[model samples]
Target: MSVESTETNPLRALSPQDLRAHAAEALTRARERSVALTSVDDEDLVRQHSKLMSPLVWDLAHIGSQEELWLVRDVGGREALRPDIDDIYDAFQHARADRPALPLLGPEEARKYVREVREKSFDILETVPLQGRRLTEDAFAFGMITQHEQQHDETMLATHQLRKGDPVLHAPAPPSSRSGPLPAEVFVPGGAFTMGTSAEPWALDNERPAHEVAVEAFFIDTAPVTCGAYAEFLDSGGYEDPRWWSERGWAYRSEHGIDAPRFWKREQDGWWRTRFGVYEKVPAAEPVVHVSFHEAEAYAAWAGRRLPTEPEWEKAARFDPATGRSRRFPWGDEEPTPDHANLGQRHLRPAEVGAYPAGVSPLGVHQLIGDVWEWTSSGFEAYPGFAAFPYKEYSEVFFGGDYRILRGGSFGTDAAAIRGTFRNWDHPIRRQIFSGFRCARDARPSEVA
Candidate 1:
């Protein structure tokens, strides 16, 4: 149906029957996609594009191993079909560029592994009740695994397009702000509001049991801080300000000597950045992507603003229902269109801020649901009533300290996987994904005078 509605009511709340059906559908899709590999030659297989992503072969294996690891090993089947799975396909364990080629399962072997894992996962889906304690844990883990594989599938498509160097018209972007400055601000009159979403069946350990949080009224930039805006901060020596950076952020900057955005290079005339394996001059109005939290904070401080707290951001995005909170997405229950947000490989890059006024949140915030994952002031920690599901490794591993919370979605986000309720978190120093920030303010009480 609608984009927002679909995202809000994704199969996360599915019955075991639903899970089984979805798994079957996904398996069929994955297997069909596996056949397409025959078309890609050796020349296409080894072509390295982004430093962050691996080759197409690695991606396929990783997805297979993922289904095997979560569904077969952890769920219905106690045994792993591919015992050497971790050594062969652990994407997190080794960088694609640094590590040698994997054991390289032939097309037949890969298909076998994929089939076995799919069957076993489906078996669990059929029998396991989707409600109980262990089921909750197992389902979330599989859910994450599923969403993750879906992400890689999109990446596979990008890599193919990059290898072919497709025409830009086929991948047109959101309206540009090259015409002029974007809208000034979107104000949210804040109050006590529930933060996070958990009423549904399968929420990540990070977004658990929705909790009530209070936020002061404040104004947030209608769009994410743009490259042109951030460039001004750098030109004015924003990085040199100790007041702007946290201790760890400063150390990271100094050690790496990060003077500008990760993809940027200074030219005699102006700054330029690489996009999808090609270098292009920086567009002033486009939302800044590929920025670390440290860079966002430095720019915010330079502008005399601050990043919104996760609660503040949540309040801006979700509309509380009288019976219980239920605003599916920012622009309401409709699915995303080109006019609402830049998502689902529509642009495959950040667009100018405030381009989608129609997608503005109830509080008037623009692009809160997409363009890029916006960094918040809050760290990645559990909500008040948080509990660990079967997947203890999901969010608990990085609690109390290192991880930072980012609300909203990005271009890479699946249309079905994004909602006002969805929460994505990452470590502060990490900057590989498409992420940026919007500024928020701490409202002050009016004086008696």
Candidate 2:
């Protein structure tokens, strides 16, 4: 069997028998991982590595609180395990910078509290039939909880990256793509393709109410823009040139004195990046990671291309000309395996481009599912006929022009949390989170095949 599952019905785990097994395994896996990752010493766990991130201990408790809130209380109608901590763990109630100052559970105490919550969540999972109620129909709540835990795990890993210390986490290097030179770009035929999911069993509220978007034919990079490519932008003074940037982006770049991707610096010989405590020469072939949406847009403009719009991105990543249905992932309906993409923290960094030939989109776009969260040209907004589910806090509140949309998962993103239509958004200036981009160009009438 594969290390990770081929989640045919990714959200609910497919059949009732499978749902029971999957849910039990998923819940246990999440719990074990939560404990394992928080095992860092007490001070480090509670310390806020970056202003943008919550302390490691907070995430540990928050995951447990969320599981209990959703699975234990909402689905099973159980009493709150600890109602007092609700506000402390409530993501919206407090900002990340303020979290460490709030009264929080210590590492050991957090482990104990979460384990007890896990016991009750298991009780609910074992007894609850996968039927009735919108939340339970496809076991959506359990899937949501699993994805939620995984998302936080990734965030905690990012915190580790920002910490000032020797490496606390390490993994074997990614498998070599061993791919030599390859095509620069692939042409995606123009037309209307379904852009969102209506039937995806585990899709979030933001991805609901499937709609068709008409996109003109365009050319997209075969692989993500690599560090080598980004270096040219830096060398050519891409940042110094205002022509490549929007007025706002230029202002942010100039105000912050930003000149290169975050975490990058020149070390005599060439550009070097520090990732997860290991400082090394930037891998020229690896897809560039940790760039912001604004930096990505500037790079695209420098290359005489623009970031692909959300629909154009989806069509390239999901649409298959031979089949009229959109696939759950870039590769197909099956869930992720190591051979398909670098996901679930299996690799400490992204694989070199062209490594995952099996993970390419039907239109031949490489690395569309992983390596880095690719920036898009769209703003965060609801789809036509969109409706928030279970709660509006999940997606409805964040809808607006203030946030830009990013597609595809990064190397640290878990398989359970990402798909072809999965949507992630953040303010344009934030770059600490794993992010990168690919360039696209409008296909002229003569360029269409």
Candidate 3:
């Protein structure tokens, strides 16, 4: 295991040659990380580190194995590697960490395997020209795979740190705090906003077949629910009270034994949270992040609030009354700036809510654009007359399922990828991403029924 080039920025435009070179470099690093696993005693490799970190051996194989499956095997190429590769390394398709162990390669041999596959993937990438007919497909596949690996690398780093009993990670600086409430509640006079994307730059199929959506009036929380506020829900026994939960949500909560948010631990002196292996006092004013849809819904119920629907979120964010049109972003058509929202810090962590008040939408909602992803009441379903986008797996797999909509980008979100029209989805119970929620209310007088 050795360090060569540690360049992790794989999203920038690259020539065919550069793309190949970068892929090979990343594969080499993946191998090195894997080889490092071999040096760990078998007992240590198999030990449970933490939920945030997987076993090193599992991570190493999963990274390479997933690349081959998604990019090569799924894309019509034969699986050219070990037949049992999926059995050994598929994290999503398979969850058992203790699959029949392969003849574990010594560090050097494993490195060679990683290097070889990486080279092959790179070589294959070169065949698709930067501006060719297959450009969209190649970009989407490579970009998604690249993103997956990058996330695994971060996870591996966390795993290593946790195994060594390191401290939790905090943001480099505390996010700017806001006192009290917003200046005034933002009322996005609701109307039709075009929902979803039609543009061809690396979007999942589910985000495609762009369509216009009619939304009625609704009032959204000016800021994400703060930790201080959620604390009130907890103090009121929100978790124990079943009336606040949907039947499915109640079941999920019981299955997981969830009480407070996932990372929270009540201590002798109030609440503390663990992040990236370290534990720190939970900041009262920071947005209460990492809460599942179930948890968010439950909290909202207890607080006499409701989650906003997707159109309601967009109306508050991108709608401009003068034009009666939605801008690409909440602030305007211009690209995101730090002052507008929190994003793309190399270290992944969300800023305090309302830190970027200037970026508030026309409706005066703060952090409507970025911070932690805000859960909406809407589900992940296609709009009327939705057709599949080019990337078939992106939207086809999850349509009409239980996944929920999360608007606003997160701290880790790619700047180029975010827009008011962009939509993200996840299972309602999953809360690993930096996610939070804001409250909403029916704005129509007749909604009182």
Candidate 4:
């Protein structure tokens, strides 16, 4: 199915005018990200030595190609703009490491091509009926394209992080405060709550068909595990101890010789980390980031705790006991504000753990929506009644044990693309993305009392 079968829902019927506005905003955001990802010089855009990420130029043109396929060809019923270049831009067709070797478009050519495609997309949007047909109905295809571009924007941001160069991007630091101390952990009084979204208009397929999940009461860290906390783990020989790691995690750690988070190095006096091409002493209060699922799990085990299950993470972030409903964000139904969370690339690093009291959940869990994508102890899988929409590759192909679910959005995540129900998945061993975790534990009878 191309769209969720929700015909009776009026909210899905986004007006043509509104859809046009959204399309324009999304394109503008994508363009801004493109500029952020590449330098003025051509060499930076074409450089593709990083095996983990795509060349910035390829990502630029691929965004345009996706828009053309969905908006121009599918929704507008128009002819292809560059049919011959389709295979080259197809993500599944080529691995990231092999992309640079391919005859991809140059920076200038890519910029021009994307500009032309976006112009056509806008032309189609002005006239196309925003109703009828799964693809065109409620302008789902346009919304999908917008979200797709934003996802690529986040990917390009990751590429920027991977590239070795002076920092090309800058943003004001997140607000800092001396907010008296917070509890070490908060109790998530559990019962049944909707685990996914059935009513959110733009929610993807995997997050559809809201289902009830019952979780036992648990205690979750009020703030994410911090650098100081993780340092304690490392100092206690956490990495060398096999008991703290899963069999696969131990194997991966031993093979890679990983003793701490990626981008971290030891110095004569203390630990340091690289952030946005600048190296500095690790901030003790900020959430430890660039950690993989394995590292998070190992750290939890070392601390005598465990990663929260995906449902537990969602319950903590979105569930409201008063209304018996899940709000669109941790701060309520309103769109994210700067006071709410550290997002939209507003900062190069996460805010201090206890900083965003305004963004705290009803249960007093802080920074649940934005800061870092929190690793959960759940495999990526389709919810019951889930159906593939538009394409199987989006979510269907990745349903398995190989990938893990990470809830919430990172500091680099675009506010437009993130919601309470948004689910991000990556291989367990992958650490390049901004990832961290909070510890959770079963609430014993005495603790609850």
Q: Against the true structure, whose TM-score is highest?
A: 2
Off by over 4 Å in 1: 1-56, 72-80, 86-112, 115-142, 151-170, 175-182, 240-243, 320-326, 333-339, 447-449
Clashing pairs in 1: 2-335, 3-334, 3-335, 4-334, 4-335, 137-390
lDDT of each: 0.69, 0.87, 0.66, 0.85
Stretches of candidate 4 off by over 4 Å are: 1-15
Off by over 4 Å in 2: 1-13
Please provide, for model 3 over 1-449, each residue's C-alpha lDDT reduced to its tens digit, 9 standing for 90 to 100: 00012111233446666755655554454445445434565655655566544566566566667667765665437556755556656454544444334444433444455566666676666664544445333355665566556555545544544564444333475357554456534555555766655543444555565567787777678788889889888988888999999999999999889999877899989889877667788887778888999999998888777999887887787666666655667777566777788864333456676677657676567887666788998988876667664445657777779889998877655454466777888789976667898898767776423
Q: Which candidate tops lDDT?
A: 2
Q: Write the per-residue lDDT of candidate 1 for residues 1-449, one digit (tens) a residue.
A: 11223235556556567766765565555455444542456545555655556677677777878777776776655687778767768655777675335556755565566767777776777676555655544355556666666567655755553443533323666676432455667666655666666654445666767666766778778778888888888778877777888788889999989888777888988889767656789988888887888888878887888988888787777654332343666777555677777776666677777678778776666788778888998887778878876556656766877777887888766654566767777778766777889898766565111
Tens digits of lDDT, candidate 4, 252-299: 999999989999998987899888788899998999999999999999
Better of 3 and 4 by lDDT: 4
User: Deviation in angstroms for 249 in model 1?
Assistant: 2.6
RMSD of 1: 5.2
lDDT of 2 by residue, 250-288 (tens): 999999999899999998999999998889999999999
Candidate 2: residue 317 Cα off by (Å): 0.5
